[model samples]
Target: MPNETLAGLTILVVEDVTSIRSLVVKLLERLGCEAVCEAADGETAWHHLKRRKFDAVLLDFELQSDDGVSIAWRIRGDDGLINKAVPIVLLTAHDEARIVEAASKAGVDDYLVKPVMPDRLGLRIRAAIDKRQDKLDRQARSTEVSWKA
Candidate 1:
């Protein structure tokens, strides 16, 4: 990967806890992201998504109003949203197989347990972005091929 690959990226962080959100934003800044927006709940995050675009979303598993799984599901299923394909990385305290499975089924691109290390978080973000980009490229190519036929 290129140096400071995340330098121009905009990220949305959805976490109900103020301290966690702040910590994540700080780390993202240090990791070279240009912008990091914070939302305390799923509804707020959805609103932000409608108003602006983000390169990725970091979502907390437990929120006061909406859980990360439901938020991720809504994002993936919502046909009207332009940011539907945005990569979602779920953060949670649980490391159980059930939690990870549920997150995967909800369309989360990545999962990280609590007390996330900066290095691991950076790696996860890079992986998720690359994965999303690859999927978009494949879809675009398929569409082009279909149109040519």
Candidate 2:
């Protein structure tokens, strides 16, 4: 990857706690991300998504109004929303197998346990973005190949 691969990427962080929310934002900024949009609850996060676009969403498992699993499900199942394909990374304090399995089933691209390390989170974000971009590139190439064939 380049020195500033995520230079202009935007991240949406949904965490109910003020301190944790700030920490995630700070970490994202340190990783060269351009903007960090924050939401104190899942409801507010949904509102933000409706108004603006984000490259990825980092959601907390437990929110003041709605949980991350529900949020993930809604985003994945809601066909009317344009940001449904946006990669979601669930951040939670639990490391249980059941919770992880549930998150996976809910369409979360990745999960990170609480007290997230800045380096690890950055790596996850990079991998998710690269994977998504690769899929898009492949689809575009296929379309072009079909048109010329």
In each prediction, how many residue pairs overlap at the backbone (N, C-alpha, C within less than 3 A)? 0, 0
lDDT, residue 27, model 2: 82
Query: How high is the CA lDDT of each candidate model?
Result: 0.91, 0.87
- Model number with the top TM-score: 1
Candidate No. with top lDDT: 1
Clashes of 2: 0
Error in Å for residue 20 of model 2: 0.5
Q: What range of 10 consecutive residues in model 2 has the weakest lDDT sum?
A: 1-10
Which residue pairs in candidate 1 collide?
A: none
Superposed model 1: Cα runs more than 4 Å off: 1-5, 144-149
Per-residue CA lDDT of model 2 for 19-78, tens digit only, reads 999998988888788889999998899998888889999999999788999999999898
The CA-based lDDT of model 1 is what? 0.91
